[model samples]
Structure formats: C-alpha cells, structure tokens
Target chain A: MSAEAERDAPAGVDGAAPADPWRRGRWPVVTILSVLLVATVAVSFAVGVTAYPPGTIVEVLLAHLTGRPSTVARVDDVTIWLVRMPRIVAAVLVGGALAAAGAAYQALFRNPMVSPDLLGASGGAGVGAALGILLSWGSAGVQLSAFALGLAAVLVTYTVGTLVGRGTESTLTLVLTGIVVSSLCSALISLTKYVADPDDKLPQITFWLLGGLETVTVRGLLPLLVPVLVGLVPLMVLRWRLNVLAFGDEEAASLGVNPRVVKAFVIVGATLMTAASVSAAGMVGWVGLVVPHAARMLVGPDARRAVPVSALLGAIFLLVVDDLVRTVLTTEVPLGILTALVGAPFFLFLLARGRRAWT
Target chain B: MGSIRVRIALATAGAVTAVLVAGCGQAPGSAPEAPESSSAATRVVTDVTGAQVTVPATITRIADAWPAHNEVVQMLGAGDAITATVLIEKTAPWLYVVDPALREAQTVFTNSTANTERLAQARPDVLFTDKSTQIAAKTTELGIPTVQLGFQNYPDLKKMVSTTADVLGPAAQQQAVAYNAYLDDTLGQVRGRTASLPADRRPSVLHVYSLNPLVVDGTGSIIDEWITAAGGRNAAQVTGNVRPVSAEQVAQWNPDVVILASSAFVAADTGAQTLDKLRADPFWSQLPAVRDNRAVINPTGGWHWDRYGIESALQLRWAGKTLHPELFGDVDMLAETRSFYDRFLHHPLTEAEARTMLAAQDPQ
Candidate 1:
C-alpha cells in the first residue's frame, strides 16, 4: 500500500511483501536453547539417580539402550523400571506438552497468564480421576477416564468461547470461558467428595488431585508417549509460523498467515499433549507457565528455539522436583505443592531481573 | 507479577505454620485436659473445644456416632442417655444382648454431610466420636459437646470404654465391669487352650480381603492382638493395619493358615465357584495355605469389623477357632456361640440367626 512497502515487496502482483525466512540471527538463540536443554536433562538425571552416581547412570542407561544386561539388582530394577523410569519419561512429556501449550495459549491470547490448565482441563481431569477412584476401576481405567474428561473440558471451553464470537473468540473471551468451565468442574469435584466413602474413596480422590508419579509404570508410559510425541513434535516444527502469528491476528493475516487455522492446530495439538500427560501423571502444575518464560529469558522469544528449549527445561525441572519430593522427605510431597513452591519464587526472581525487557 | 510474589510469600508462611503446628500438636500436653467428674467438686478446669460444653449439673441425653464409645457408655451405666447410634453392628451379638433397648434408637446418617445434619438434629447433651472418624472442628462449631475417643489400636479400645464409663455414671458402670470380665475370661480360655502347643507348631495366619486387593489387617488391628493372644503367629508382621500387597507377595508369604472374613470376601453366593476361581488362578494357587486346605471364610457380618469393641473381641474368638480348630477339638463352636451370646450378648440369638452369622465354610 505504501511506497516503501511496494519497494520491499517480492516483485509481484500488487507488491505484497513475502514472508521472511527464519530470522538470520536465530543461530545464537538456537545455541542458547541447546545449552539450556542439555543442562536441564543433565540436572534431571543428576537429581534422581543420585544413588547410582552420574557414571553409573550413564552405564545403566547405556546397558539398557544397547540391549546389554544390567548389573543393577532385581529390586533396583523394579524401582527404576516400574517406578522411576515411567515417572521421569512422563515428567518430560508432561512438562514439554504443558510448556508448549502455555506458549501457544500466551500467543493466542497475547497475555502472560494464559496456560493450558487455564482452559479447565486440570479441574475436569481431577473430577474424572476422582470418579474413577470412587468407582474402584483399576489403574488403567482411571488414567483413561482422566484423559477423556480433560479433552471434553477443552472441547467445552472451545465451544463456549466460539459461541461468544462470530467464528473465532478473542483471548479474553476464551480465558473467561475457561474460568467458568473450571469453576463448574470444581463444584462437581466437591460434590463427589461429599458423597465418597470417607475411609477410602475421599483419600484416593484427594491424592489424585494433589498430583504424583509415585505409581507410574512402564506399561502406563507407552500409551501417553504416542499422543505426546504426535502433539508436541509438529507444533515445535511449525514454530516459525507460530512466531509470525504471535504478532497479533490482523498483522498475521495481512502477512498471509491464516490466523484461524494456526490457532486451531496449536490448540488441538497442545491439548492432546496435555490430556495424554495428565492421564498418565495426574495434574502436575507450574512447569507449563514457568518453563516457557525461563526459556524465553534464556534465549529470547524465537518460537523455533524456545519450543524445544522449553520442553527440555520442563522435563528437567519436573524430574529434579520429583526427585526432591521422594528423597527430601519421608513422605512424598505432592507434585503440585513442590511446583508452586519452587516455580513461583524462581518466576519472581526472573521478573525482577527482566523487568525492563518485560515492559 | 507482584500478586504472584505475594502469593508465594503467603503460601510459604502458611505452609511453614502448618508444618510447625503439626509438629507442635502432638503429645498429651498439647491436647485439652479430660473433663472431670461432676460428682467431684475439686475437678480441675481446662481448655475445651467448642463442642465440649460444661453442663451445670446433669447429662440426661447423649448420642454417639462412634460405636467404639458404645462400650464406654454401656460401662458407665448410661444406656438410657443414648438416644441414637450412627450405625449398628449386629455381628457383635452382644450389643443387642447388653441393652436390648439400644436397638430401638434412631439411626444417624453415615455419609459425612448427612452425618453433620443428623448430629444437629439429634441434639444430644454430649457426642462421642473419634478424631479419625468425625470432623471435630465443624461438629464443635455446630453447638454440640463432642469428645474424642481413641481407637488407634486394640488397647485404645479399653481406654475409650473406661473413659465413657466414667462419664455415663452408675448402671452402665456395672455393665462395663461385666463386659471387661467377659473379655478377660474369653481371652483366658483361648490362651490356656493353645499354650501347650510348641512355637514351631503355632499356626501362621494370613487375613485377606478380596474386596480390596492386597489389604490385610496388621500391627494395630485387633486381629494382631487376638492372634498373639490366642498363641498364633500373625503373618502381617512387616505391614501396617491396612497394607497394599500384590497377589505374588501373598503367595510368597505362604501363610500356614489363610482366613477371609465375610467383610473382606467378595459378596458372591457360590462358594465352590469362588474356591475354583482361587485354585485356577496362577498367582493364588501357589500359596501354601491354599494347597494345605487351611483357608477358611468367616460368614458375613456387614460392616461390623469397622469398629474395635466387644464385637472385635468376639470376631477374634471366631478367628481363633477358624485358625486352629483342633486346639479346642471338643469345643462345639455352635454351642459356644450361643453360650457366648447368652453371657456377653445377653440377647438369645435364634438358631436361624446363629446359622446365618457364622455359616461360611472353609473355602480350601
């Protein structure tokens, strides 16, 4: 439309500027992301497998990966295989999914507070999980019910938000819808608690909502891995388009990106990853909201690099926290409590340092 | 951002306070002093939770949702004061015998929310419930005088019974003395009969609940006390009152005698079908108890095992018979049941009632 715009245009029909290729200065961001990712993984393994030492961890992992028989004891094998491994894998998947979802939500709403759980997914998952326990359905059935209910909650949020608009809802409307849906779900959860057998069922319901990977097994890990991979991979791969869309809907459309389509893909992909992770590990909190910010601060706001970096950091963050919970106290600390305790303080420190950048 | 900082600070302070309070709130020093007898004018005054109302002179009516307190009230001769019971355990047989009029008291709701409403409606002068069994803060706030009765283990039962006896006054006090005598006598009989057996010959017993997989009563349970008292070895030595065990773990323990209470066994009709299912299962059949034909199923008693009172003692006696029937070979359990009923239960159980209450034959 302007003379400068015409001059900068890609030499064709009406002089619209072609989309820029991945930013030329992204290499530094990429390097920083790799460093953070590796560091987080290193820290995760360092905290959890403390009994075996770092060298032993490497040897054990190498042996397992290479089809060589492990020298670990049978009891340790059960502990690592049935308990810790599934938990660590689940943490990585959940953390990555949640952080990526948070990033997508923030981009969609153009607000800092938006996270995957903001859409009532966690509350719905908790209620469904509580119901599953009350019904005395064994382990697998409980996880399945939680995931189904989480997806249903997301679907409800999306539908209600859409009804408030012509085709697509704005970030504010979407958030409002999520709050209402979550409140409704929470009320139902309370009602369930009221009727539940106090001696057994209520305790189970409370424990599920508190969130833990205490009983996660390798068999449980298999089903969640598929959806997490499917959901997280494509979103990270398409980060370039995601970055453009973050510039605001009108600007993104003027630049030839279909804002509606991108939003849908990101939401669905992120929701699937979140639902899968929750079904396996319950409603672990804070990593999604905090990890993306940490990633952004470490490597600037380039989605291509930030997505993977956030995923790695999230996995690493949760693993270390979980290990702390198991080893630090005689009783396992609830994952949600630890996350808030650790994440909230770290976030505040980050905000203090990056006050100018944030503004 | 500032709000987040505030939340973090507040949560940190609150969590620290909670941990500190939890730590400090142990030991008898932290608990309120027990209410003194009205008959004694020199009774020491103490801080009371809202539910602990200091009556001017007399306590006419009382309601107890916690059946553990029933023996205490009965022992104090305050049967007339009890207007309602939260739930009844017919398996004890003695509760009916001790006070036939107790059966006529109104039933209070068991589910928590309704229980609260029922407490208000009952409006008794005093309410007895255990800290574990009821919401103390809310109940106290509802303007009812509440007392905490301990039931952490079997010994706690004697303490609760004695405490309630003191509060209930005279007539119920006589019942308490008789009940205690009965307990000592019954326990004495079992102990005397089995004392001659060598330690090596002592039956190792395993109690299983098919309803909740791997749940077995352990150290704090009356079963543990009964087994030890009856000269049998408890198989659940390393576990807690309610333990999570895998089917593999149960088989590996290979208890000398396997027993299932009616409460623990799934409420299915076909005994042969149940036995066959157990025998056919790869995991369950490997148990030595199963192979030796030592597994027995106690008849259904409803939610009777939920409390540890005289009912618990009776169940223990029944468990002792099931575990080592040969120790008392000439002891006719049917005749023993009726006699025990007449002496402890006070009410005569009809032949039909007696048959239905203890009819689950040995599954092995």
Candidate 2:
C-alpha cells in the first residue's frame, strides 16, 4: 500500500496540492489495459482442449479474413470458428456488459456496494430460465423468457417506486422496492425448482443456475449483441452525468442536470445490460460487483474513465476464467463459481488494504 | 325458559358420558380383534439401504415414493396394492398405460417429499422410497414401515427389485426370481457376443442426457455400465454422473456413436428436434457419429431405459443391437420387447406399440 502511495506521489510532490494521478496518467493506463485485453484475446484463441499450432491458428484466421478455404482439416476449423470463438465472444460481451452496468449502477446510487442487479434482473432471469427448463421450452425460449422477465422485473420495481415515493427521496424508495421485487423473484425461482421433475428438469435447472458459457452458439450470440450494445452506448454517452449525479441529487439539480432523468437513464441502461448478460451466460456473479471497484481503484472515481476501464478489466477477468474452466479439465466448471472464487479473495485483499476508491 | 334450557343441557351431558363409557368398552373388545387380523402377521426384511423393517406378511396397502420403482412394483404384480404414489400419468405415462388403477392412487408426495398427513390418510401398511436418509427417518417417525430402494448398476437393480419383492410377499418373491433370471439371461446373451470383441473393435460411445447445456453421462454411471456391457467405451473421460462438457471437448473425444436420452417430458418429437438442432450445429455436424449418421436416440419405456430402471433390461439388448447389428443381427427387438413386457409387465404390446416404444415415442 505504501509502495503504491509513493509511486502515485510524484504528481503532487512539486509544490502542488495532492493531485489524483489518474487525471494525468489516464492515457497510459488505458493504453496498457487495451493492449493487455487484445493480447489476452489472441492468446485465448490458441488455448483449448483441442490443441492447434500457432501457425495453424494464424492460417485459419487469415483464411477466414480473406474469404479463402483453410488448408487445415474441417474438424479443426469447425472447432475453432464455430465452437470456441462463439464462447470467447460471448464471454467478452457478457463480462463487459455486466461491469459497465455495475459502474453505472454504483454511480447512480452513489453507493460503492451496488452491482448491476441492484434491482431484480438476475433474480427475474433465473425464475424465467428455471420455468423454461421445467416446461421443456428449449434453449432459445429460455433465453428469450429470461431477457423479457428480467426487464419486466426492473420495470415493476421502478413503477412501484415512483407510485409510492412520488418525488420524495425516490432513490431510497426505489432501493426498498428493488429489494422487495428481488426477493419475490427469488421465491418464484424456488417454486419453479420445486415443481421441476427430479429426474431431468431439476438437474438442468441446477446447472443453468451455476452459469456457464458452453452453450453459446454463433446464432445465439447475435441476439445477445443487440441488448448489450443498446445498453452500453447510452451508459458510455451519459458517463459524465453519472459523475455529476454522484454529488447528492439536490446538488446535481442545481448544476443544471436533471437528477431524475439521469437516474432513469442509468437504471434502464444498467437493467438492459444486466438482463442481456444474465440471459446469455446464466447468472454470472462477481464481475459486476467487483470489477468496477477494481477499475475505480485503478483510475480514481471518475465514471467517464472507470466505466470503460471496468469493461476492459471484466472482459479480461471472465475470458481468463473461462479459458481455465474449459482447458483445466475435460468437464466444464461453472463460470460463476470460478469468478467468485477469484473475485471474493481479491475483494477481501482490497478491503484489508483500506484503499478508499469511493468517498 | 332459562331453567328449562339448563335441564336439557344436564340430560344431554349424562347421555354423552354413557356413550363415552360404551366406546371405552368397545376399544378393549377391538384390541384383541386387531391381533387376529392379517396385519398381526409381521416379518422382517432388509432393504437396499440396509434397514431391517417389520412389515405385514400379507401387505395390502403400499405407498411408493420412487417414480422408477412404480414400474417395478407393477411388474411384480402388486400394482393393485399401491394405495399412494408419487408419479401420475403425466410424469410416467407408460406406467399408466400398464396399470390404470395407479391413476386413482393418492398423490401423497411432491418433489420427492411426502406430505405426512396425506400419506397417513392413505393408510399404507408400508412405504417405499429411494435411498434418502431424510425420507426414511421421517416416515419411520410416523410409524409407517419405510423401505429404501436404489441402484447404480445391474446387480444393485436386481437387489432393489428383490428387496421390493421381499416387502411385497411370496407371490412377488416368485416373480422376482423370474425377473432376475430374465435379466441374467439377457446379460449373458449380450455379454457372450460383446465379450470376445477386441479393444479396437469396440467403438467409443457418448450418452448425452440433455443437449441444451450439453450434459453427458460420464464414466461410473448406469449409462456407462450399459455402454460397456453393449461393447462400447464411454467417450466422457471424466468420472461423474450427468457432467456438463463443452462442444470442443466432445469434438476432441470424437466418439463413434452419440446416443441421446429421450426427453422425460410428455411433449412429442423433442428428441427429434434436439437431433435436428445438433445436426444444424457446425461443431456437431462434423463429428464422426453425426457424419456417418450413427447418432441415435435411446429407447424409453416405463422410464428412460438408459437410466436406473427395470427397462434397463431392455436397454441392454437395444444398445447391443444398435452398436453391433452385425453380431446381433438375428435378435428381433420387436419380439424381445413383446415377450419381455408380456412376461414381466403382464401387458402384451402390439407390434405398433412395441415399435413406438423402440422409437422412444409416446404410446399412440
């Protein structure tokens, strides 16, 4: 901790007030993270249960890029392009979406502990997926139901909050209503699990709850892209307003930014991203709660910088975890378990260090 | 008017006391009669869970909590004694087709947990459930004799059926002997053909339990036992039941045969739809099994044949025939199914019904 403080002291040592290094070194940090992300993605392509030589991977990529047939066997090409690539892309999208949503949510609520599922998206999506499995609705039906129900849950919470609170401390009322809706969604999920057939549907529901990226296909990846982009674009555009809203609601209102409008946009964008990620990956935890904190620790509490940096860190974290999940054993380890296993300990370390990323 | 009402109440209370005395007298009179009844004759038998339970020698009422064991009881000719059951026509359709009386049985359990009040109302002389310590202890506390039956392989299945028969009576005991003999004979026949095959001759087989999450039955499971008995190696290298694996891992294993378990749901054509979806996937389409059209759905009967059920007897033959048609060319599956169901289940199937069962479709 002292070492980090000393390293960061240079910007303030020359007769100036203690200054945040992020404002000055933002480009360098962003550049290094971007390069690391690209390198991780490239290395992930080469790692799998089915080993392919570096040359063969390059040749396969070149063939796909130039619209030429690969000299490698069709099986190898299919394994690379169809099976592994879809999973990798899904990991990046899901991780990035969850973390960006988390950043937006924490900024909106002015709470460091908040995650993207501050409302009821994950809980609602879980219930929908469990019901779909119990009813034998297939994979696509499950994904669609999950996404719709997730959005519906947030909408219900927002509606209840507005109706009850009117205009008096709506944020607090929203948080209260969100907890209520989240628990209701959890009970519904449990009901679905209870009625599911012990032989078949129970195991499927259990596995789906554990969460993984093994089921992602090229066709399925396309629908996920729409909601994630729709959610992320708005959050990135409204990042500065998120910082403004960090100062209490009355202060933001005096500063000419309508706190209510910014908060609504933030909720909608975060809910959309959270729902889309959960629908695709099935309740992947910790990425949303932990990655934004890591990003803020790296680049200070500026949403404009933290949001994108959190997206990159999350993408890298999940991609590496997924790579380990697939390659470490013949069987697939649930992605949520690995993320928690890595995130929880790292979070405790951060807490022990007592670095206040949030005031 | 108040004095008259008090007199009437006093008279009623005196009559109620007189009737209560008579009821007490009848209780002692009926106490001796209870020992003279059939329930007085009790015998002890050990279940698969190794709990020795005292049961009525001539059991008349039973509560069957294990869905798969419903078929076993029906096959043992004790379907009429099942007063309570966990499964209905929707969950186990074939059981209903075999014994319609089961439709009228009390559904005293849900999600494998029994409602004790309903189960008590059913007045079951004995309770049968899977090997769950909780259920056994709960039912035992209710004074209902609990028999826990479960199996992982063929021998354990035989023990389960035999224990179930022991709880049933002498008639079912005789039937158990016949059923066990039939299983032995089938295994002997299948193993006689498959045992001589060299390692290179046996193809690697993958048993997919579900396709949505790509869960497959790995080694050390009932699926693996049958795959081995039918002269094939399990493609899943891991050791667990119903393991989730990646498509890339499947491609790496590149099994020669892919067997999809029939959907437990009642909806028709789910297996075929899953097969089509697998065919559409570029990763699955290129596998040796898919390329050569060797990927097939496992036949289901009273329960999924590949699972831990009595139909595993049929699965032994079907898997053998599917894998090594050359060696088992003379074996006619329709005749085998017809005879087996006739002798064991006591429900003779027509050629069309047998074909439907073999195709893993619902009885039409």
Candidate 3:
C-alpha cells in the first residue's frame, strides 16, 4: 500500500522525512479509471436476455450515432438504441451518483464506513416509493414522489440538528438526527407495506424495495437528469475545497476555509445525488460505500481525484452487476442481492490490501 | 405469562369437555336452540392448520374471514349462511347478485385483517379463514372455532368446495358436488377438443396478472392450467405461482396471444394505462402479441381469473374460445356467463350484465 503511494507521489515532497501519501494525487489514476469505465459500458451492450450479434450491434451503434442508415432491422436498432440505451444510461447515472455521494459523505463525515445515505435519504425515499405504489401513482409518479420525500427527510433532519445544537456540535447532532430519521423512515415503510393492498400494491412494494433498473425509461430519465446533474456539478466544483475540509475543522480554518459552510455544501450535494439515484433505481446497496474507498486506494485521499474515480468505478461496477443480473438468472435477480454478493468479497479484499491507506 | 398460559389451558379443557357433552347428543344438521350457548352441540374437526376446532354441528351462521374463501362457501350454497364477511360489494359483485340480503351482513374484516371484536360480537358458529398463527391464537384463547382453507387452481378449488361443504353440512353438499362437476366438465370439454391437437398447433398464451411490476402467471399458476386446457401453450416457463418477469422475457417468448388480468381498479381508473401503456413501452411493444394487437383482457368475475376463486370454469371457457375459436365456435362466451350464474347461483343475468361481469374485450 505504502510502496505505490510513495511511488505515485510526484515532485514537491518538501521534507527531509517524506510527503504525506494521502496527498499523492490525481491525473494518472483518473485517466486509467476513465478508459476502464468506457470499455465496461460498451461491453455491457452485448449481454441481455435476447442475444444480439456483437458485430451487428457495433455496426448498428456506429451507424445510428453517425446518422447513417443501417442495414440492421428496425427491431434490433430500437432494442440497442432505445431499450438498451435508457437502461445503460440509467445504470451509469445511478451508479455514478451513488458513488460520488458516498465519496463526498466519507470525506465530509471522516468515516469510510458511512454510505451515501449518511443521512436518512434512502430510507425516506423507500417510504415515499412505497406510499406512491400504494396510491397507484404509476412508475414516473413514484420516482417523483421518492425524490421529493428523500430531499424533505434530509432537510428535516438538518433543520432539527441545527435548531437544537450548540454551535459546532451541530455536526454531532446532525449525525444523531440522521440515525433517528432513518429508523423512523424504516418504521413508516413497514407501516406502509402492512397497509398496502395484498394482491397488487404489496408485491409492487416488496419487489420495488428489493430494487432493479429494469423499468428505466427515456421519459423518466429527463426529469432525473436535472436533479442528479444539479447535485453532481457542485461536488465537482467544490472538490479541492472538500480535500481541504478533510483535514479537520481547525486545519480547514487555518487554511482560510469555513468548515461549516463547506460541510453544508458537500452534504447538500451528496444528499441530492443520493436521493436522485435511489429514486431512479430502488435502493441499490454497496456502490456508494465501497466505490469511494476503492478509488481512494488508487488515487490517495484527494477528493479531486477520488470522487471522479469513484464515479467511474461505480458506473462500471454497476453495469457489470446489472448485466449479470438480467442475463445470468432465469428470473431477473434483484440488483441489491448481486451487489452484496459481489461487493462484500471485493470489500474484504480492499480492506486487506488497502489497510495502510486508511491509517 | 404463566397466568395467561394457565387461563388458556383451563379454558381449552372446559371447552373440550363442553363440546364432548353437547356433541354426543347432536347430529350434523340439527340446530341448537341457542347459537351462542358455548356448548351449542359442538363437533370436533381438524382445520387445515392441523388444529382441532370444536365447531357447532348445525352451523347456521359462519364468519367468512378471508373473502377469497367466500367463493368456495358461496358456491357450496352457503352464501346465505355467511353471517360476517370481508368487503363484498366491490371484491365480489357476484355475491350480491347471488344473495342480495348479504349486503347487510356484518363486515368481519378491515381490509384483509379481521376485526376480532366485531367478529366476536357477530358470534358466528365457525370462522372460515386461511391458517394464520394470530387467528389460531385468538380462536384458542377465545372458544370460537375457525376453519382454514385456500384456493389456488381448479383442483384446489374443488377440494376447497368439498371441505367447505363438509364444514357447512348436508344442505350445501349438493353445491360442492356441482362445483366439482362444473370444474371437471369445463376442463374436460376444453381438453377433449384440445387433446388431439399437436403442441406446435396450439397458440402460445401469455397471462399478465400485474402491470406495475410486470408480473406474469408462470407455471403452477391457475392461469397456466387454463392455458393448457384452452389448447394453448404457456409462454412463461418460470417457476412459482406468480413471478415478476422482464419485458425481454415476454418478447423472447413472443406469445401468439397476451391475456391481461388487471385490477378492475387499474382498468377503470388508469384508462391511459390499459394495456396501451404496455404497448407503448419500447421493449413491450416489440412483443409479437402486442405488435399484432393479439392482446385481450381477462374477464374478471367474482375475483380476477388469476386470483384463486370459483370462476375458473368461466375463465377457462373464455381462454378456450380466445385460443381456439374454430373448435369452440358454438361456445358463446357471454351466453356461457349467463348460464353459469343462472345454473350455479340461480341468479338470472341480463346480456349487458353478463358482458359487464366478464370484462373481456379484444385489444383496440
């Protein structure tokens, strides 16, 4: 772990002892992750329930993108461009959002174990989605309800924590309130499930709760793209500041940064990304928690490098998982199950190999 | 906890002794002078959960706790005997046509959950329900006997009808026989015509039961039974009674016909979403069934055709006609609906009413 970090630490070491490996940052790692992510997404197109010839799929893709008429059948063209495109795009968007949020959260909270829903967003969104399904709101309506409710839940927790805290101790209060709100959201979800109609509503809630990217449509993606981009752009803009804030409030203050405001901005950005992703594709577990930590191992703890790397890794990882889910199983296996099955082992591997990275 | 356990044991012993004493003097159909005397000629019978319950021998009144179970009981000519039931008007409009007086029957359930206080107040001789620990605990703690039953397919329906007849006694016995006979006759008639046909010749049928999650009735579902009987191949080979399936699966199967059994709720309210929405989805629209407009809505009577109930025969006949029109050419589905209601429930239906009951329409 130390060998790579030391080797990757370029010029300006500024000490007789050495440089802090955590600041051994960016460029090279980002370039590699970018190449890998694009390759993984392109490969995902060939895998599905219906088999398509890879040669034909590539030709159709080139023709469609370049605005040239394809000899490919209309059905195959529609399947590749219309059907697979929305799902593939959704996978990238949801995966990237969750991982970025998770990275921002791990940085802001100074805890690697913390997930994207360091606040109550995912749990709260679950309650919203369940209620929407119970109300027969249809697919798009449920997504909107989930997005609205998730943001509302976090705002409530943030408000309560700020209103009731002793100055800088609000961070402590916010974490505690997030825990309380998450528990409350879970209870409300259970209540909603219990009250739901047995035949139609109950199964929808149960299946939806397990999570999938099966229903991602182009129309649904338009509204979702706004909130997700709105969330992500700020995180990208504030990446260097996020790195500064990671060194503790006193250190951040010494470096001419307001710890409270930076923390707030990061939290809002991360929470928005999380709520948007969860609303789009039910509660997909592990991507947010694990991806950032893996990215940190490669690029050091600089948010500038780690956050984008996490987004790329998360997008590629989820595309692979979703591909395996739809193709490998006879019935569409729930996305949550595959992530944990695959993530837990990889996380254990990361823990062993990157133990020094954390310390 | 100790006191509660002792009280339960004591109550059970007392009830057992009381039932033994009264049951010795009673026969199956002889009514007690008072229905709620606690020892009103109790007869011991084992419920589906394997719990022995001491119900009154002449059960003039019963609380049909699970409304789906009402189909079996109603078909057993015990519709008038159900003193308490779940919501009837919406879930089972057929029950109203069969027995108008049941409109005033005590609503025993709050949605699917039993209102135990209201149920106790109503004082039915036995409670007809599916086996659950809560209900079993309640029945044991209180001295009310409960019978558990479920209907999954036509064969299971016949068994439930027979069991309901046994529970309801001799007067309802004929209806159980009629139900068994009707089920056999319907399937038999469909099979006799369909049996000789080669597998390749049969239409491949897709039975979509839910829309939001896009679930299909796979193998072991009642819809599968109807499809095979109706001389059609079941498109979905997935296991389990009902399973959430992908659009790709339906597209891959590419059934000759698509039959949707949605909530009359979705059909009536989401007019925009009626199979048309499915037909609009890029993946779903590509399905051969959707593309050719070979989709038809399942005619819901009593409960949905996919939902376990008494209307299997009607659903089967409907599927048969849809799948094999030439073979079932003489079969008038609307006329069959009228005849089934008239013969079984003894309720004459107008042609408009029959059409309304079936809710079957070819895709626009």
TM-score of chain B of each: 0.71, 0.88, 0.82
Kindly indicate the candidate among 1 and 3 with the higher lDDT: 3
lDDT of 1 by residue, B1-364 (tens): 3223323432342343233223322321112222343343321111122223343235667777564456556545565567766555443344555565677665553322113333444556667764322234334534445565655455555555655654554554566677767766777887788778898978888776553566776665666777776667888665445555666666566788876655565555444456666666676677777766777665533224323555665665676666677776666666666665565445456665566556643211
For model 2, how does the per-residue alpha-carbon lDDT over B36-153 read when each residue is reduced to its tens digit?
3343778898987567999888888889988888889999898878988888678788778988889788776644334443454466889988754434554564457888777778
Q: Is candidate 2 or candidate 3 better by lDDT?
A: 2
Index of the highest-lDDT prediction: 2
Which pairs clash in the backbone of model 2? none
Residue-level lDDT tens digits of model 3 in A88-128: 77787788889988998888877888898868999989988
Error of 1 at B148 (Å): 30
Runs in model 1 with CA error above 4 Å?
Answer: A1-50, A53-59, A62-67, B1-364
Residue-level lDDT for B38 in candidate 3: 48
Give the lowest summed-lDDT range of ten residues in model 3 chain A.
Answer: A9-18
Off by over 4 Å in 3: A1-19, A23-27, A50-55, A62-68, A167-169, B1-364
Ranking by TM-score: 2, 3, 1
| All candidates: TM-score of chain A | 0.85, 0.92, 0.90
The per-residue C-alpha lDDT of model 2 at residue B103 equals: 77
Residue pairs that clash (backbone atoms under 3 angstroms), model 3: none
